[model samples]
Target chain A: MEVINIQGTDDTPNVILDKNNNKFEISGRSLPEDVNMFYEPIMDWIDGYAEAPNEKTEFNFKLEYFNTASSKIILDILLKFEEIVESGHDVKIKWHYHEEEEDMLEAGEEYADIVEIPFEYEAYTD
Target chain B: MENSHENHSFLDFAYQLYRTMKTNEISLVYEGEVTQDITKTFTSLTEKSLAKSEESNAVQRKVFNVMVECLQNISKHADALSEEEDERRGIVMVSKGDDCYNIITGNVIKNGKIPGLKENLEQVNSLDKKGLSDLYKKQMKEGRISDKGGAGLGLIDIAKKTGSELSYQFKKISDEVSFFILTSTIRRNN
Candidate 1:
């Protein structure tokens, strides 16, 4: 599959899904007005990638902020990874948040609790 | 002479409104059509203002999140007062109090939607933090997105982030339409 590299905008996030480079990260804000239209292709790409499967998939979520609608989409993305794990593959999520953003950290914890995959949290400072 | 007098009255009214906003410590007040571009502009403006005021990053993020939800709610769900009017028009205001910042939004909605919306807000308000968290997860997993692109989780998420009861009011404008006002508060010290 081809790599998906989308530059971040004021309301959207930067997404990079490259199997060759071993980089799968989504960072920045996500509050797109048309959530479905903005995320459909990314969801489709993941679905296609789940077929071939990497040896050990490590996904990173370095989101500064996301709205409620994007929260649902993020959950969906996590659940998709869980499906890959259920099919006898290794997948881990690296949840990155700012040290001052307890809310973002808690959001990561919530997502970790809801999903069956392992999540490793890392805090950063500006 | 008559036209000049009318112009003078209009200017006086505008000055009075500006004074009221300033006295109330209203940082931003927008009353017009709510669109995607407008949402971006409003959030960016608020973000800059919050940062300038020396608010903590966490509080700024919370305010930005709540404000986005409020503005998107208006853009997605606001109803026209008449059949011919198609634009989504609403009013959004951000005001600062001693301890908390308030995000208030108002828009016209169909009368038939009042009961369901009221019930939903009441249910969201009645839950504790754990209950709200559970509800939010459950809804995220099971609830389908509406035609308007809502995940049915905005209210719950707003309540969760604010950690306060959501206050609201509904005023009947006519037999077919009513104006709905919702206020969500975020404490500065939180």
Candidate 2:
């Protein structure tokens, strides 16, 4: 699987999906004016990756902030991973949020509640 | 002798009240050259308002998201209201009340857009929470980016976050521009 990397802006987040290393990372602020355009390819890549087997799939989300629309799309991506896990693929999600931001931590918890993927949350000072 | 009983401090008393009211309502107004710079000020004001309310994290996030969308809506679509050439200018005010926070944004709208803006607000006012969520999800899926504006999700997002109906008015300023005032309130969760 080829890697995909997109830069973040004031509105969108950077998405890095390293298929070869089995590590996926999405970080930065996400408040896109048109959220679907920003998130569509990330979703598509995850969908395709689900079909192929990897040794381990680790998805890390380090988001400073994202709008509600982007939040829903992120949920959709997590749900897809849940399905992949159900199909017996080893998958996990690491949610990194700012230490002071309880909102981001709660958001991660909300997604974890709905999906079956093992979600681990870590806090950073920066 | 009867004229001597007339009140002499009427203007002074009224001026005192005016000062008190002005103090209670904090105003942070900005007039800038860049559209993006103007948006940053608005965004910071919104965050400060939300923090003052001390709402839960979820509610605060919702408010912030709606705020971003609304300001963007104004930046991209509102008619120029200031002397800045080729730059959009509008007013966004956040005032604290006893039990609610008031967010008021005023901008100039071109004559033709009045109907569409009115229609969207009317539709948004009619939806319940669940319905608005479903509608927002649907719009996110179908709404496309255009040169004109965003996914048209600004009003819906504001309505959903505020849990209050959007209030707006269109007043004729001239043949070319109309004043559009949009007000949304977030009630304190008890």
Candidate 3:
């Protein structure tokens, strides 16, 4: 498995998924110019990784903000992880939001209910 | 107040607003090729405008996000092939009002979308703060199975950001297309 990095933009977020260090994270603002174009590579990479898979896959999502289009893509990514877990891989998602942002905390809970994988919510102060 | 003469050109509309801003000496206008491009343009415009006067950065970001969401909503759902639409191909205007920022977005909505728009917006406007928050969570859990395009979260975000209710109107152009206008307001902090 190989790691991929996409830098954040004024309208989009930064994505860093490193297979070597076993660290996968998505952070920053996420209102992309073309959401499909921006997320396709990330989706493809995850699909490829789930084939060989690791002992446990931990996804760290720390988004300061994201748009509606992005919410769907995040759901799509989590659903793919559910498939990986169904195949008996250990997978957990750590959903982080700013301590003051209650909306984001609830958003994490919503995704947790939709996907099969366990999602742990954490609030952090910047 | 709406113009009863019904001028459909975006340039005409922009010029009108531009004249109003020049008199006040405290606003900016932005144009771009796409919805996201235009959003970035307006984001910078707002940031620079506010920073010039040394306004609150946090409040400016919230207002900017609300403005961007309103614009994107028009770009994603606006009806196509209209001659009146601007060169960027959609009409989203953000102007500085006396004590607030006003966003006016014009788009074309297909006939089928009007019913859903009315229903969802009605539900949104009817909800209290707690109710809207709960509805946002509920919709998120159910996913985007019913949306015409995306998760239909923009309106909710707009509502939350400004703490203002959405105001909309639909002008029937033909059997298939109706001109949709959405207006949202953000109060400026002194």
Candidate 4:
């Protein structure tokens, strides 16, 4: 499958989905004006990746900030990984937040509770 | 002499506006069309101002997030007062109190939207934190994004982050339009 790499901007996050190198991560801020237009293709790629996926998939979400619209899209992306898990594959989400950002941690916990997948949190310092 | 007199009066008006802002603890104010580029500029400017004040990281993020949502709400939902004007013009102001920061925005909206918006705001204001969280999750799981690119979750999300009730008012502007003002407060100690 082709790798999906998108550079981050002031209003969008950087995304990299590569099954070849076993790298899948999304990080940075996300507050795009047209969220559906920005996230549709990324969701499609994930759907394709789920078809012939890796034995173990670890997706990282290291978001600095995201608006409510992007938050919904993030959940959809996580749910896709949940599907991968239900298909007899191992999937773990590494949720990264800055040490000072308690709300981000809580956000990850909330998503973990909603989705059936396992989540490991990683806190970092700037 | 006429040009000098005009310049003197302009400076006086400017100084008066500056004094009002200072007295109100307002750090930023913008009144015009709110596009994506304008939203970006406002957020960045607020970010810089918050940094200079030595606010906590969490508070800075909350203020920034609320400001973005408020600005985008205007961009998506604001209606021009007249048919000839097609811009989403609105006013946004950021003020700091001793204990909290207030994000205030106002825009013209159709009078027909008043009832539904009122009910929504009342419903959101009535919820506690847990209820708001549940509503947010439910909406995220089920709510469809509108043609205007809203997921109907902005208010709920703002309530969740700030842990404060959403305060709002609608002033009738004409037979067909009203000015809607919304203020979200974030406590610094939180």
Candidate 5:
């Protein structure tokens, strides 16, 4: 699969899905006005990867802020990863938050609670 | 002379509105078409302004998230007046009090829609934090996104992030429509 690299905008996140390196990372603020239009491509990419995922797939989310619409899409992304894990690949999700962002931390926990994936928390002092 | 006088009065009215907003602790207020570009610019400005005075990035983020949701709500659901269906007829305001930040948004709606709007809001207001969390998770799994790409969790997210009950009202503008006002508050200390 070819790598998908999307640059971050003020209202959307940067998405980097590197098939060769086996790294999938999404970061920055994502509150796109049209949530579906913004997330549809990423979902499509994941749909393709789920059929034949890497042996060890790692995903990282470092969102500073996301609206409710983006929140649902984030969950959809994680649920797709569950398929990758179900196919026998080891999957790990790293949820990052600033030291003072308790809400972000709690948000990660909420997703972890609902999904059947292990989530690691990394806090930045900034 | 008449045109110059009209311009001067318009300026005077704007200046008075600015003074009134400042007196009420409002840091930002925007009334115009709630387009995507406006939503982005408004949210960014609000984020930068909140970051300057608040210490916790968490609170700042929460505030920003709530503001985005409300502004987008305006853009998506605000009733267009007529033929052209312009995304106007909306107002968004932000005020910082000593203890909290208030994000208030108002948009016109067909009068008949008030009942459904009130019911959804009341249902949201009835839930506690845990209940809201559970409801949000349930709605997320439903996968029934609105035409505007909303997940039907706008009110729930606002309640969860702010740790405060939502307050709203409907001001009747005519027999067929009204302007809905929604106010969400985020605390300075958590």
Candidate 6:
């Protein structure tokens, strides 16, 4: 499958999906005015990627900030990965959050609890 | 050089509001369209101000997070009748009290939306932190998210962050609109 690469902006996250390299990641601050508009394409890409699923997929999320709207979309993205795992594709999620941010950590844990993906949390200090 | 009585009264009203805000110990305020650009500007400005206040990292995060939610609530949910430019105008402020920090936001909402909004706020206010967290997890699992990216999660998140009952008021501005003010508080000790 062809790689899907979208650059990040001040109000949106960067997304990279490559079935060839088995690489997938999203990182940045997400506070789009029209969240559905911003997320639709990524959702489409993920749905397409699921058709020809990669043998192993590791999705990294390094979001420094995101609004509640973006939060819902993030959960949807994680749930899509669950679909891949259900299809016998190996999938994992790495959630990177600031070490001091208990809020972000709990947010990661919340996603991990609802989804079946082997979610690992990596914390960093400033 | 003209000291009209109407102008004097207006100045008095402005001074009264200034005094009220000062008395509330407000550190930040923005009274205009709550656009994405404004959110970024206010968040960064508040970040700098919070740093100067020497607040703990956790407090700063809570304040900033809750502030962002309130601002988004205005941008997403607030309404305007017709195409008036000021219809999108909103009021957002951050005040430091002795016990907690208050993030207050106000915007015009259609009179029709008042009942449902009141119900939603009351439902969220009725829950405690644990209850709110459980509700958040349940909603997340159930995938009750809306197309606009909120399933009443923002209010729940604010309640969770504030650790207190959400406070709000509605002032009827016209037959078609009401000015809605919502305030969430984060305890200083937290």
DockQ of 1: 0.82
Q: Each prediction's DockQ?
A: 0.82, 0.17, 0.32, 0.80, 0.77, 0.52
Q: Model 6 off-target regions past 4 Å?
A: B4-23, B81-86, B141-150
TM-score for predicted model 4 compared with the true structure = 0.96
User: What would the per-residue lDDT of candidate 6 be over residues B1-190, giving only the tens digit for each residue?
Assistant: 3669889999999999899889989878778888878988888888888889878777888888888888878877888744564447789989999888988899999999999999989888888866888888876666555644555678988888778899999999889989999989998886
Error of 2 at B155 (Å): 1.1
Please write out the lDDT profile of model 4 over residues A15-121, one tens digit for every residue.
99999999999999999988999999999999999899999999999999998888889999999999999999999999999999988998898898899999999
| Candidate 3 chain A weakest lDDT stretch, 10 residues | A98-107
Number of residue pairs clashing in candidate 5, backbone atoms closer than 3 angstroms, sequence gap of 3 or more or interchain: 0
Against the correct fold, how does model 1 do in TM-score? 0.98
Assess the local accuracy of residue A18 in candidate 4 as a C-alpha lDDT between 0 and 100. Answer: 93
Q: Clashing residue pairs, candidate 5?
A: none
TM-score of chain A of each: 0.98, 0.96, 0.97, 0.98, 0.97, 0.94
DockQ of 4: 0.80
| Alpha carbon lDDT of each predicted model | 0.94, 0.73, 0.76, 0.93, 0.87, 0.84
- lDDT of residue B8 for candidate 2: 47
Clash statistics: count for each candidate: 0, 0, 0, 0, 0, 0
Query: In candidate 4, residue B26 scores what lDDT?
Result: 95
TM-score attained by model 2:
0.67
Model 2: which residue pairs collide?
none
Which ten contiguous residues of candidate 4 chain B have the minimum total lDDT?
Answer: B143-152
Error of 2 at A82 (Å): 10
Model 1 misplaced stretches (Cα beyond 4 Å): none
Q: Give the per-residue lDDT digits (tens) of candidate 3, residues B1-190.
A: 2554455566678788777778755354433344666677777677677768644544565666777677777666666545565443456666676677777777777788899998988888887776776676566556663343456778887776666788989889888878777778777763
In model 6, what is chain B's TM-score? 0.86
RMSD of 3: 6.1
Q: Please, what are the lDDT tens digits per residue for candidate 5 over residues B1-190? A: 9999999999999999989988888988878888878888887787777667745777788888898889888877889665467665699889988888899999999888889889889988999988888888888888567887778888889999999989999998878778899999999888
Residues B113-142, candidate 1, lDDT per residue (tens digit)? 999999999999999999898999889889
The candidate maximizing TM-score is 1
lDDT ranking, best first: 1, 4, 5, 6, 3, 2
Ranking by DockQ: 1, 4, 5, 6, 3, 2
Task: Report the C-alpha lDDT of model 1 over A9-76, residue by residue, as the tens digit.
Answer: 99999999999888999999999977888999999999999998898999999999898889999999
